[model samples]
Target: MKSDVIADWAARPGRHIVNLSGGKDSTALAIFLHDKIPQIEYVFCDTHKELPETYDYLDRLEAFLQRPIIRLNAQRGFDHWLNMYGGMLPSAQVRWCTRKLKIEPFEAFVGDDTVWSYIGIRADEGRSGYISTKPNVHPVYPFKELGMTIADIERILETSGLGLPAYYSWRQRSGCFFCFFQRTGEWVGLKEHHPDLFEEAKKYETERGGEHFYWRQRESLAELEQPERIAQIKREHALRLEQERKKRPNRPLIELLGAVLDAEDDERGCDICHL
Candidate 1:
């Protein structure tokens, strides 16, 4: 991650873009690079299924940067694709949602252009963000290149006055409210914080031709919302937090919450969609 490499990308004589997910990492990346790359373009692929807080966070980021964030929307939209695929909801295994709603719109926007796509993955993160297959689209990692971690990201947001999204108080990842990657506790959080949206997510659970489809594996939102089930999830989450606190005391609650969620399931959420 040489400084000259980054400078070379900056002077590539093409589009320089940062894709925002309305989450902390990508938001922090945008703020960090606001002054560095004057020609940088910020874009967000709107699936029309994101949480209300994510949309609000983007508006604030736009105002802070003093630049317009180009929002790309798919022509056919989510519902059309869902119906075309026989109502099978997108899962980690079959991420048609990411393809149709997120990646496709982004690739279309940078058609045949030698674009430098700035990704927000931290150095601590083991996975890479979504890299387009298009030869013209080159991926760049500023935070990773600088060896920044979660603490560094938090400091950037705090200094910029754009702290974590409001939903981070409950849900950690920022994507569709009904993202299939959601853990039991996040599902409970969605129900508690945004009940109407929670209800909307529940409507998608269906038994199509005797094949049950739910956001959470082996559990439907209706089942997860049961008072007893929610209590159990809260109890388990509390125990995890208690254990994590013993290892690292005086850490931020948001950081603690994110660690606890990751311990529940090691499967990293979508890099691009949940950045």
Candidate 2:
């Protein structure tokens, strides 16, 4: 649907909301739908542990939107949840983080209002993100209905003067600084780009009892930081990129990025946080 058409939907009396995840797709969607949905409420479920780049991107988006993107949080934040979980750290198998940090806050924001949530799942993507089961919160997919693909999303962000998230240079999705869904190479990038955040992530893995947990099941940040391991991960990533280029020479760099991440680790990222 065109912007004018969607504008009509936003012009209605009921609450219209868009959740920004600080990721490329969601950011693009916010930019694309901003002028069209003049009254639409924009929100971000802040985990309070996101990368600095994420916060920066949100600020840029907020300026572009010309309004506050409401920040939601559980009464306490990530540290509170981590302490409650005995500092084990959240993984795909037990994603208490998403439920507490993202979903609950979003639900609380909507409250009893009948909200129309606009999601940014592209037409090319096969999987669905978080769609609230709340009877009052209706989810709508403008990208899907309009058949907008990855190329279209890039165009939207490019034209709107809000390129891509800074993290896109290494990481694909946006979430917490130490999201378990990150690839090994991206983890390396994290260390190189933001060593302090990397160290903070490492600190979360160790506890008072001397017990240690890791974001990746097979590796720890200390081990991953080894020069040899970092070199190996870089080599593997380079080889994978070369192989991907051979397989799909005509695809854009974005598509190649998705493929590379899938090849390294296919864990589906947090929908509520990454959109």
Candidate 3:
């Protein structure tokens, strides 16, 4: 079925696209197919709420690819969507943010055309791409089909001169700075690196006359930003990193950090947002 889908898409004269997430995997996939698929359209569904590093990484990737990456954006943006949703912040269980900010714009871009969506999910990952369910949109996993792993992705980025986004040094995944999927350590990283954004995220959390909303399910950002809480999170993250390093002494720092973060929060984030 995979081979048939690949062949069918190759034979069709429809849209060929790769959605970038400003993360390593998607950037590597874009670089991997830069020469192989000249007609491939690279796109980023800009939430307009992503970290500055994410935008910088996307800019670098565009230069490396020597092509424009179309930025798909929601007509109203996050603030508008939040209002429409009754100021209820999106959570893992109620991920209306992904649907409004990412998927809707992507689907609108593809319209009714038969699109072959190239995904960057690696063979080592046990998750599938989150793409449009529309019958016209066909999802394809190039990295998985090609048997590429995390190491292969790193090699691709390195060879292409587009290494991982700077955020990887601290946070493992990529999405909005205030993404609810962020672990406690990542939230601390945000507070330390981008305090202004952290403040903005905190502003989002409010009682609003008896309705309590928080980015994290258990605690509010205000509470998480406390000095003692930040220190505790850092200590826990350090312990995890130490344990992971002891387990895999030869692993790359980036891989080790990712493993630690995954161990911290096993939930695989929104595939479209974090790929």
Candidate 4:
């Protein structure tokens, strides 16, 4: 049944939408599908707490696709929802952020309409894509079905002149700057690359009910931002990257960065936001 998606995608009775996360796989999927699915609508479920690089990458992708990438968001931003949760910063164990900032708004956008959600999960990925609870919204994995791998994704992006997001240089996942899923190295990268955003993330780390809520477990942004801490993280990251590079001498720098970051901690990030 899954094998038939590509053949009848156009004839399917639903609105087709490719959800972009401003990441390589999703962007490449959009590039691959734009000409094939003319009426396909591209969308980004903006948490509004994302990096500036993410928005810029989306603009470039929009131009390449020559289609408007619909920007969807919750009625209120992250701050509003954070307050609603009583200062409990969303962690892996309790991620209220994904539902409030992403999925809910996406569901609202479609509003009971039959929709085909295009996901970019590739052949190499074993993880599932965003399978909506809404019966009307169906997921179609073109990359997986087509046996497209990371190499294919990178090729597509490179060919389109819309390479990976600028954040890719340091961060693998593209979500909130203060995403609890981020590794210590990524936090270091955030501080070095986008210090203001790093500071903004720090503000969320607060003491509520005598317990300090931190994005990273056992560590606060304030602690992570210290000069010695930053240097330590950088040194550790460099060492890890060197080991990974030695393992795959021919791999691209971006891929190496991903490997090194994942080596630090591979939580797979927020499934919905990483899409």
Task: Please tell me which predicted candidate would have the highest lDDT against the true structure.
Answer: 1
lDDT, model 1, position 150 = 92
lDDT of 1 by residue, 159-233 (tens): 999988999988889888889888778888888889999999999998877788888787888888888988888
Q: Local error of candidate 3 at 56, Å?
A: 0.8
Could you tell me which residue pairs clash in candidate 3? none
TM-score of 3: 0.94
After superposition, candidate 1 runs with Cα above 4 Å error? 1-6
Give a tens-digit lDDT track for model 4, residues 182-226.
987888888889888888888878887777888888778888888
Q: For model 2, how does the per-residue alpha-carbon lDDT over 108-207 read when each residue is reduced to its tens digit? A: 8899898989889999988687889899988888898789998899898888788988888788878998999998878988999999999998887764
Model 2: ten consecutive residues of lowest lDDT: 204-213
Q: Rank the candidates by TM-score, best first.
A: 1, 4, 3, 2
TM-score of each: 0.95, 0.94, 0.94, 0.95
Instruction: Give candidate 3 regions above 4 Å deviation.
Output: 1-11
Task: Indicate the worst ten consecutive residues by lDDT in candidate 4.
Answer: 1-10
Candidate lDDT (C-alpha), each = 0.88, 0.86, 0.87, 0.86
RMSD (CA, Å), candidate 3 to true, equals 2.3
User: What TM value does model 4 have?
Assistant: 0.95
Clashing pairs in 4: none
Model 4, total clashes: 0
Runs in model 4 lying further than 4 Å from the true structure: 1-5
lDDT (10s digit) by residue, model 3, range 1-275: 65564565566678899999998998998898777767899999888899999999999998988999999884667888899998999999999999998898889989999898999999999889886789999888888887889889988988888777899888988999999999777888888899999999999998877768898878898888788888888898899899998999998888888787878777778888998
